[model samples]
Target: MESTMQLLNKALSVQRAAAWVEDMNLSKSAISMAQKRGRLSPVLAGNLAIKLGENPEHWIAVAALEAEPESELLTRLRKAANSWRKL
Candidate 1:
């Protein structure tokens, strides 16, 4: 079984994570939607105590604390993208 913490909010940037979820090929609109409506933030945040699942601010704070370093996160994203290509 996978730990919830490891699986949840794996990407600090919701836009990046959304891109990953959206087949790892980034869409500009996906980024814009996350900024405008925070459509992806809570899905990334996962298992929060907040009433509304779409709390972008809380998502940002948690992501900052839980996220891997920038280089590491980018590497992970890169690996995901490549894996998608193989599929």
Candidate 2:
């Protein structure tokens, strides 16, 4: 099962996770389960990326901004964006 950290890493957008759940297709309770349960939802995070039509690696980069809205996430995101472009 994918850990919460893994989901956070992949989605790059914690907001997307919240949104995905709010979309009525999923639920926060489900997310909580995925997070709290004994790794049954390992694929849930990856599934979220697929459902969002996003690349898994980039998903966390996209969501990282939301993950840390008040601090260095933005600066780090900028640097990561520059780095990503170079690659």
Best by lDDT: 2
**Model 1 off-target regions past 4 Å?**
1-20, 23-52, 68-87
Candidate 2 yields a Cα-based lDDT of 0.52
CA-only RMSD, every prediction: 13.4, 10.2
> Model 2, 1-87: lDDT tens per residue?
123456544443546557756763775676666555423243454466676564555544444433444567677666667666334
Q: Write the per-residue lDDT of candidate 1 for residues 1-87, one digit (tens) a residue.
A: 022243333443333445454644445564455445433443444423132244445454444433445587667765665543333
Candidate 2: misplaced stretches above 4 Å?
1-4, 12-17, 38-43, 52-87
Clashes of 1: 0
**lDDT of candidate 1?**
0.43
lDDT of each: 0.43, 0.52
